[model samples]
Target chain A: MEDNKIQEVKSPSLITTPSGGWGASVHVFAPATVANVVCGFDVLGFAVNEPGDEVIMRMTGKPGITISKITGDDGRLPLDPAKNTVSVSVQHYLQSVGRADVGLDIELHKKMPIGSGLGSSSASTVAGLFAIKTLLGDEADPAKLLPFAMKGEEMACGQGHADNVAPALLGGFVLIRSYEPLDVVRLPHPAGLWCAIVFPDVDVPTREARQIIRKNIQMKDAVTQWGNIAGLVSGLFMQDIDLIGRSMKDVLVEPVRSMLIPDFYKMREMAMGMGAVSFGISGSGPSVFAFTKDEETARLITQKLQQHLTGLKIGSNTYVSTINDAGPRVLG
Target chain B: MEDNKIQEVKSPSLITTPSGGWGASVHVFAPATVANVVCGFDVLGFAVNEPGDEVIMRMTGKPGITISKITGDDGRLPLDPAKNTVSVSVQHYLQSVGRADVGLDIELHKKMPIGSGLGSSSASTVAGLFAIKTLLGDEADPAKLLPFAMKGEEMACGQGHADNVAPALLGGFVLIRSYEPLDVVRLPHPAGLWCAIVFPDVDVPTREARQIIRKNIQMKDAVTQWGNIAGLVSGLFMQDIDLIGRSMKDVLVEPVRSMLIPDFYKMREMAMGMGAVSFGISGSGPSVFAFTKDEETARLITQKLQQHLTGLKIGSNTYVSTINDAGPRVLG
Candidate 1:
């Protein structure tokens, strides 16, 4: 333990294994997330079961990293690892762990629609870094990997925020307590809380959705939002379904972001009128979500929402899931 | 059931009786409270055990209200029903519940220091209105009386905010979810959560405190503050003492208002260093509070805080108690 002397460490075997350890490959799946989740603007989020991403990674035989295959996405995602959201996150993780020289092969599957306001980029990024995390044998607490996810977001959207990635990576409900310090908390997840999301076949780019928002909000709005944020957190923990429904309202972010979604007000009204507990834009978007108490209610609402969309003559995807408690997992 | 027909009722006896009922007098006590409760500005607060107000009131001989007596303080409180904080609230309550014709006699005991950041005016007002509420056969919910308390604050502080009066009236930790419709929620109380407060012989008027704070906050600060507010609420509900301690931070209000309190920084540092789970200005300034897990820790902190003030020639009063669950009660 001499001062300033390097400590001894065990060396890994160079030989490849059949499973995803060291030289072998691993497949990781990260769920899609709903950011802002009503009252929490840039702060609260939760994971859903449908619309996620899958990434495959392994130590490469040659130097540096290689992108072997990309699926689901129609050539929209970049091939270069540096330009891709998932690969960029892997790079950040590798560099931070002092393993930048580690050569890797990567593959990505974008199951969720790109630019659909369903946390597509964050899902892919979470899957990528998480896949690598398993191969590298988990050094840091899983929450520590959030910064790498932000790096992925920065590479993909040119701005970084954790509202999506935190929940996508850690599951349950997560609050981004502070951005400058990058602190996140996993709130107590309530049982029987289900979510229904309708992803309309429309695109609202994250960058453009962000640009329309005012840099400063009225203090009046801030106070309303503050109380609701507290109420929303309480609703989730207390497991009071009506309280959660009433609290899941967005006065600050949705009023500004809702312009991008067509018939946003009518759809929200329909959801609420049809027994959805609370309704709001999921992330920045064309995708909207409603929270309900039961799977039957969620399914009924999803059918009505889909039937309502028939008038527009566009194919839309609707999903109902219990709040995803397990965030990312290795594909067995 | 007859349209626009006035219903006949029995005439009341002229003489006022001993107990505050239809023909008697009733004595009511309301406790002074600390608003903002740290990270929640204009949104959160709780009741303290010591330094509160008492009011005595009952039906009068005449068809109007009378301020029979006022004691304590430097004669700042008014006697006129409209001008006095207590009387105006009583007036508002009577008029609101269609009991405006009922006469009332009122006496106020300013047991707590006025302008001490101890919710002096709010306590007196709450007591006066609540006394009448108990006497009126209790038709309206107790929370319905909050507006009358706010009317009192309006007369006293020139602006009405419910943070102080809500906790004083309801007891325990309270969150003002929406001010417009005036939605208030009583959050779940944490077990073994004790609060300690110290009042130095200094006055920082509520008006002055309100003036110093910047109406608009930076978006970055708002996000951080939002997270802390949610965390504080969660901490309280979950009964996580450490989490509550970590979340009781005042980035928005303290920096501005603390300028008015002498040695504020030193006092806060000393309290935190002494194992205060969280420490900050109780409501505005001159009074500071901390939350601790054990009563012994709270007692120790209070004693040391009082001792630390020995050299300053300022006599300070310190109090500690488990978070006040029962807000205000009548004394026999």
Candidate 2:
């Protein structure tokens, strides 16, 4: 690994393509993210290790961005470059860097379920952007890509929230400290932290889930929510798992959103009974997640939750993994 | 300091008094605290080094709690033990430990201003409780006295909130994560954090200050507030002064409460101009605090704020100190 005699791969790229373009194609994978983590509402999220999306990008002679192929989206995602979140965000990135004239062929592979409340669109968008940046050999900081990804989020979901896209782009647990200034802080997490995710097959539109929440909340509830929010963040810093469990409560959003998800309370009770550290709706939700201290408990929680969903005659996908420390990775 | 030949003080006490009583008197000092810290509202507070209360307690031959003397309020405080916060809290503590028969006389010395929005009553109550505990040489945990101290808060403030008392008892910055189970977490802080507190002369009752706030708040504002709360806590842990400054904004309470204080916005503007890290109304109204990196800046800001208050023909007191790491101490 320390061999200085290793051949430089980028020298060949400079001969084949223009100054800003890559000679070879690049494939990138971005992890799925869980937004609105319990009491965090529109501020906090974390990326998971499994169930992500992949994007393949390569420069071409044609002048414009195009989606050559898209898979596993059930033909629901847009094919047009202007309309699709992946292409639109990538186009924005290219425009910002004065490379809008660069031609590119993009292929999106949705390895995760759509509308699963697990930041599916964010994964796809981040993967596409990461692929382009990798191909260009861009040394710019990864956080610089967040605004473009948030634009993708705005296109996908009417709101430009960073809870999902920020974590998907930066990895680990993230706190969107401010929206106007777009201050996103990547926080430290306990090494033993594992997430148990269950995407139950239920048709709950994100718009409808958002509409169901109360626009005006009591001051008492807001006080409670911020307290828990502080506690959860403190727990992450202190690496105290029990404090995290105690503080992962959502009195504002969960009470109303839970009505859309069948057996939400029952699943929470069962998850907690099985030693799950904390459990709550993931994002706007038909999906849910439970935090655990070990991989074994996380796996057990997913298994039990999937079984419960099955008993209700509902299909579900389950995943057990630690937090994704690295945001996006390059694939051959 | 490591000498094992140090005299054991408890041996002489055992011969003169019964199991639950002490022969000698104890004098205690508890630091004043700033509650409702910016975006934290009712859930966060921290102790300051100056302007605290002192309590002197001694065991008597009589059988009940008594307030023998009260000073520094111009006779505003009550002499009756049942009505006074200090004696009432100490009585509750005595009852909880099955020592109601243990006689006590507490002298209340108000070192801090009353109703200055600086938790004056909480300091006195905590000081009284700490004095009794010290006299008895109680080996019980300090946190065990929180419930009893909170009763005094209920009598003084009409709400059993622990934002003031918790920090006064535990020292440092504290977060009351939940009110039901009464969970308090002491958070880490930046070592060089200094506070500039200016208590302007005004008559803003706590009840009226609270009643002025909107019971129902917009969801967007709540989200913003919690994001700032998380950011503030994270900044404290990460020791990021800039992040803490950016996140100390309070959109809900400050807007309404600032109206009660004269020239609140102008002071904030002046303090920010003078290199203060953050500025906001401390506790509720009348008193305001500015955070700064060093003691010199804190002292300067307080002087300017006091000068401004004087220009308006309003009397004010100023304090410059670091966060009090120790909650209460024996004066003698």
Candidate 3:
């Protein structure tokens, strides 16, 4: 609460405390994620740049949790640390390792647009818990923090899914093989892979986007989706971009979600015409992303999409960048 | 009509052609395949050794197909090469290249069981077409031979599926992602990965085995099956044998078809106990396979399975071999 406005740093370093240990005041940054990447439906995701969230934490003098500050989100996010995803995720982490009583003051810095289908909540959920885990000198796997992120994200999106959260936390390409045992596998990231993400200025909540999808998909379509999923994973591991392009076909969820996004068909057509390897919804709907092989092509694709949106008088923001390999880390 | 008895060779090399121009009497071998491969239903398969089929072929004078002799099948298979899977496959290959007039007198060698869920027909389908492809000096990719194999396999089993035929022709592990464009991805095989295949004395035709499966499966079960399929592919690529073991779970087809196999549960239990990474029905029923990391373990598992079958008074045949990496190679 002292320096209420701790300026967010593009390049952050760890803040050393009196103990001079790894667990002091830490600022962790988590990147935005693109889930349901074409063929991957609730199983595949990758982290992207530009829009993300940060969590600030410090070990408190007393032995309980406190929410000191949460900036930039307006009144959209909850104030109570118990009710917030950031601190709640920390709470879940602490409880899991039998350290729930650890005193800490939590802070949230929101940079990404909320409910934009860009894994905004997942970023906070990942960054918040990640900051505390580092501060507490916990050497456990970063993936161990994913379940907490999933729990925290459920409060924001009304679904406890790991696809977006995994990529937001682990970075690169992540595949959630099974949910029952919660098996997540990190796949090889192809070189020179660029992404053009366009978040159309529309308030399509994650809940509404999910509701549009049917409960039961056709068996044939499911076969196609799963086949593409296997092929997608294979292509990435084999480092074959052509196979990746051919495999990134989503036949199950995209058709239904496209109805919710305005001019979704045309938007995808323009992206595909510009030689995007894959073009489809990022997570659920509204926010669209396209994968390309080169950065220049990604930039051109982004500009074309923006120009088309400008012509239609629809407000939109586009981010052109490569897939983020370093997911949630300290940036000073 | 010369040499009705063409002696089969074990350590066979490439068959020398007349004038070294590729067209001469040649023998090609296709290993028996394990289709379905636990979780990949219609999309995954791998080849095993022994109990396979062979095709002996030579160019004909009148430019018309003929089946001179067939061994071991006991008249169940057709005498007409056009009707036989081996010759039918050659016919498909001929029509595809607009060289249907290129005739071949053929002989079939049925080494594998006829209808015991061991990919007997698939072996014939692959070897027959492969022999002709080699004899005609067709420089087509081995993968291009799959559709013809599918055509031939269909005649033998009354169902056209490349799951078995692809692996039989190409060898090792094969993933058929999509059938429309016939996208088949050959996966990496872990070194020393041995297969213990036990063909119990039972008659379960490929058609009847397929008939027992429900047309429309529950959506929940489909998700599980596809998830495991993706996991299996990933495991093979990453060379994570434990992950492969965990992912070899089949939730869709195995449960329904296991009813036809005697002591199916007990067989899997013994195999799993003997350190088999994966154990399940090889293709349809009666024929069971277990994947092990070493040859010694594979032998032990096979012995245990054979003993169990013997105790049950069920006649059976067992074969232990690593993945046949050299698929359908030229034999001298």
Q: Which candidate leads the pack in DockQ?
A: 2
DockQ (C-alpha based) per candidate is: 0.56, 0.80, 0.46
Kindly report which residue pairs in candidate 2 clash with one another.
none
Over 4 Å off, model 2: A1-23, B1-23
> Which lDDT value does model 1 have at A21?
42
The lDDT for every candidate, in the order shown, is 0.79, 0.88, 0.79
Candidate 2 residue lDDT tens string, B17-136? 435444568889999999988989999999999989999888888789878898898898999999999999888877766667788888899987898999999999999988887776
lDDT of 2 at A246: 89
Q: Give the clash count for model 1.
A: 5
lDDT over C-alpha atoms for residue A36 of model 3: 82
Ten-residue region with minimum lDDT total, candidate 1 chain B: B1-10
| Candidate 2 local lDDT, A191-227, one digit each (tens) | 9999999999988888888899999999999999999
- Looking at model 1, give its docking quality level: medium
Task: List, residue by residue over A117-204, the lDDT tens digit for candidate 3.
Answer: 8898999888887787677666656776777888887888788888889888888888877887788888886887889999887778
lDDT, residue A254, candidate 1? 89
lDDT of 3 by residue, B47-104 (tens): 8777688888888666778999999988888897657777777787777776666768
**Position A111, candidate 3: lDDT:** 87
In candidate 3 chain B, what residue range of length 10 has the lowest lDDT sum?
Answer: B1-10
